[model samples]
Target: MDARLNYFGNQLGAKFLKYINSAGHALGLSSLPAATQELVKIRASQINGCGFCTDMHTKDAAHAGETQLRLNLVAAWREATVFTEAERAALELTEQGTRIADAAGGVSDAAWAAAAEHYDEEQLTALVSLIALINTYNRINVIVRQPAGDYVPGQYA
Candidate 1:
């Protein structure tokens, strides 16, 4: 399957993609743990049904040595025992963040407080930024009907 438009081939999209990529780069330098970032991205992508992102993030996580059990359990993270408390906090935030429209209050105070319990201000900033970034990517991919299952690790980098 082909993208409706090749983002790189279109001058406007190419320019837009530079800013898009910058967001990813910004998170790369953040203190948010790499493993957490991957799980967040994968979970949000799953929630958003963004095939492009789900495939990319899952592959990236695997290449980074993330365990298959952990990756597979992300969708059911609330019931999984494989995650740390911090990872659980991050996952909870990711779910609420991705499903913002599903709740009237946005992310619940409990979720926010829970994330704060695990992450310092700096890591919190990164986690929030990462959630926002992956959501943006998910929306873009879903909107464009981008096909999945072909991403290679580091292809975007």
Candidate 2:
């Protein structure tokens, strides 16, 4: 299927993406574990039903040496035993953050505290920013009906 627009080819869209890409690049330099970052992106993409992002992040994570089993189980992370406590905490926070409108009060203290237990202030900052960023990416892709399943790992890198 064709996308409604070639977002990457459009000049305005390209400029907008450049700034967000810079934000993502800065996040990459943070103390947050790279594995955790990918997992968070995958989970948030899954929650948002952004097939493009789900495809992109899962492939990127796999190319970066993420296990197939773990990547497959990201959506079921709550019941999966493969994840570390910290990873699970981040996933929990991702869910709450992405579904803020679903739950009243917008990200419960429990979720925040759980994430805090696993991450330092700096890492938490990166995590929070990553969640917001991924959600933004998800919305754009879903709105544009970006086609999925053809992304090459590091294609945007």
Candidate 3:
């Protein structure tokens, strides 16, 4: 299926993406763990139903040595035993953050406190930024009806 528009082909869209991608790269250099970052991206993408992002992040995570089992279980993370406490906290935060409209109060204090217990201030900052960034990307992709399953790991890098 063809996208409604080539977001990369338009000058304005390309400029927007350039800055967005730059911010993502800087966040990647933060104290947040790479594995955790990818997991967060995958979970948020799943929640948003952004197939393009789900494909991209899962492929990227696998290329970085994330096990297929863990990748497959991200959507079922709440019941999975393979994740660490820190990862679980992050996933919970991601869910709350992604589904903010569903919950009138937004991300709960409990989720924030749980994540705080696992991450430092800088890591938390990165996590928040990553969540926002991925959400933006997800919206853009979903609106454009971008196709999935052809992404190669590190294709954007």
TM-score for all models, in order of appearance: 0.96, 0.99, 0.99
Q: Which lDDT tens digits does candidate 2 get at residues 1-157?
A: 8999999788999999999999999999999999999999999999999999999999999999999999999999989999999999999999999999999999999999999999999999999999999999999999999999999987899
Q: What overall lDDT, based on C-alpha atoms, would model 2 receive against the true structure?
A: 0.97
lDDT of 3 by residue, 1-157 (tens): 9999999789999999999999999999999999999999999999999999999999999999999999999999999999999999999999999999989899999999999999999999999999999999999999999999999987889
Clash pairs for candidate 1: none
**7-47 per-residue lDDT for model 1 (tens digits):** 66689988888997887888888888999999999999999
Instruction: Report the Cα lDDT for residue 100, model 2.
Output: 95
**Against the unseen true structure, what C-alpha lDDT does each candidate score?**
0.92, 0.97, 0.97
TM-score of 1: 0.96
Model 2 CA lDDT for position 31: 100
| Model 3 worst lDDT run, 10 consecutive residues | 148-157
Ranking by lDDT: 2, 3, 1
Worst 10 residues of 1 by lDDT: 1-10
CA lDDT of 64 in candidate 2? 96
